[model samples]
Target: MPLPLYLLALAVFAMGTSEFMLAGLLPDIASDFGVTVGTAGVLTSAFAIGMIVGAPLVAALARDWPMRPTLLAFVVVFAVAHAAGALTTSFPILFATRVVAALANAGFLAVALTAAAGLVSPGNKGRALAVLLSGTTVATIAGVPGGAVLGTALGWRATFWAVAVLCLPAALGILKGIPAGRGGDEATGKPALRAELAQLARPRLILVMLLGALVNAATFGSLTFLAPVVTDTAGLDELWISVVLVLFGAGSFVGVTAAGRLSDRSSGPVIAVGGPLLLIGWPALAVLAHEPVALFILVFVQGALSFALGSTLITRVLYQAAGAPTMAGSYATAALNVGAAAGPVVGAATLGTEAGVLGPLWASGLLVAVALLIALPLHAVITASRNTEVQR
Candidate 1:
């Protein structure tokens, strides 16, 4: 990988840390603001909303801009949003800042992926993209854990301050390092983002994107409120909760990397394995939440299997789409943001039930099963279309 890839990864690392840190601090924010934890979770929901809205909007608006200026603009947005988040004492202000930060996230990732792909020789594009996205994977493994510890010790605000500080270097790194006019489409007279939107008109493509949304909803719907669930069910302190959650992040990193490889080899088998494994693991996690050791084991497996489906699903979408790969990418990303938005809302609602800690997990498993059912026919579709090209 090029040095640019590492530089982009550092930027993504800061962004990922900003995004996931909220989960660990939801309780703290709630307490400080004198709001319910469920209410404080709106911060995450706001971020997802921003991603869903901002991804295409920014993509469309910036279609004509050279990638360097566009990405640097988004990086600045991220830094400023984090700074605002760090300074705000009011819940509404913090929430708004989170939303703005997430909007930056949407644009940053779209540009980053495009840039990463462009950074390398045509044959090595996939590798570049993978290396760039690994920053997110590393963030999951390291950033979230670090944020949780920071939030617990210095207070939640302090964690956001740390995130803001990280953003400064990330912004500068992006501005200085991204090759001028070398990122995104410098040829074909700049593909209009509106052209990409047309790809959603394909039914199979749309189905695959929706599938990504549903799958993520299944995982994060239960996961968004996992801290409280662990606290109450496992009788663990905040510190222990953070540690176990890190185990979950560890599982996710393993799952994402392994899934990417598995998809390259066989999509059908990967999804088949992922579906049942997630179905079994999620519900088991719910049952095991009462036992800390058991819950840790369950979370590890849950993280691993749940995220393992990502690359497989992305491959399926792109394969089915065939001719319109860029549109397929946009759809996949949009679906992901939609899932992120829906997860917390669903989790909050589920937690209100009498089943308490176990409710969201059961609900999440049902969502996964539904996703599997949707995916079952995808194999036949792929066979009929013969569209299984390697998707970036």
Candidate 2:
């Protein structure tokens, strides 16, 4: 991987920490703002909404704009937003900052994907992306937990300040390490925004993205409710929740690391294999939700399989939309976020209907099953598109 990819990953780490660490601080935020915890949770949804809307929009608007400056500007804005969030007194003001920060995070991510891909040779695009995504995985393991600890020790404001401080190093890294010029400047060719949009509209790309979304829906759905599973279902102590989260994160790190190496050659094959594993794994997890040892082990195993499959799908989407250069990465970001936003909703509904922790598992199973039904035939379609791209 190139230095720019690492720098982009660094930026992603800072942004990702803010994106997730808020979950642990919701109680503090709610208390400080005199709002319900559920209301404070809306900030997470705001971030997701921002990412979903801003990713493609920003990428399209900046399709031909210089990437380096745009990326730097996003980091600066993000840092400023965090700093404001840390210092603000008004809850509405804090809400506004989260939205602003999310917009910048989405824009930076979309552009960084393009820039990261551009930094590597065509064959190693998947590996480059994996390197970049590793930052997020590592953040899941380290940064989210770190934020929780910081908030516990020094209050939620300290967590915001810490995340704000992280952006400085990321901004410096991007300015120094990432190259000048548009994200498409180094690609085989840069298509106009219209052409890119047309390419993205293709059935092949849509199916690939939808499949990715469904996979993510399952992954995130189950994960969003895993705390209850660890406690009520597995009958474990509350302390084990953090351990379970870390184990899952560790598994994700391993999976994404392996996906980077394997995706270029066998993304389709990996999907074929891992896809079925996950589809079955979810239901099995629901059934095993009662056994602590099995629940723990399967959580780790499922995490590895889910991320391995998710990363492979992302690589495939990038490959399928590579013709769009600057626009390609947005498809993956938007699709995954759509799933991310939807997953918890589905899980929450099941719980509301008296499904308990097992509701999330059932939600995951149903999602993966639907994804499998769609992907079963599209496997050949994805291969055909990739072959077509290579032939071009």
The most accurate candidate by lDDT is: 2
Each candidate's TM vs. the true structure? 0.91, 0.90
lDDT of 1 by residue, 1-392 (tens): 78877888898888888777776888889999999877887777899889888876776666557766777788788888888887888888988998899988888776666565556654444355456656776777788778889888898878887887887788778778877664334556544555566666767777777777887877767767888877888888888767876887888778777765655445567677778888888788887789888998888888887777854575455455444433444444567778788877877777678977678788888888888787787755532333234331
Q: List the residue pairs that clash in candidate 2.
A: none
Q: In model 2, what is the error at residue 294, expressed in angstroms?
A: 2.8
Clashes of each: 0, 0
Which sections of candidate 2 miss by over 4 Å? 23-42, 87-95, 182-189, 235-239, 390-392
lDDT of 2 by residue, 213-288 (tens): 8888788777766756776788876556667767677788888898899888878778889989988889998998
TM-score of 2: 0.90
lDDT of 2 at 337: 77
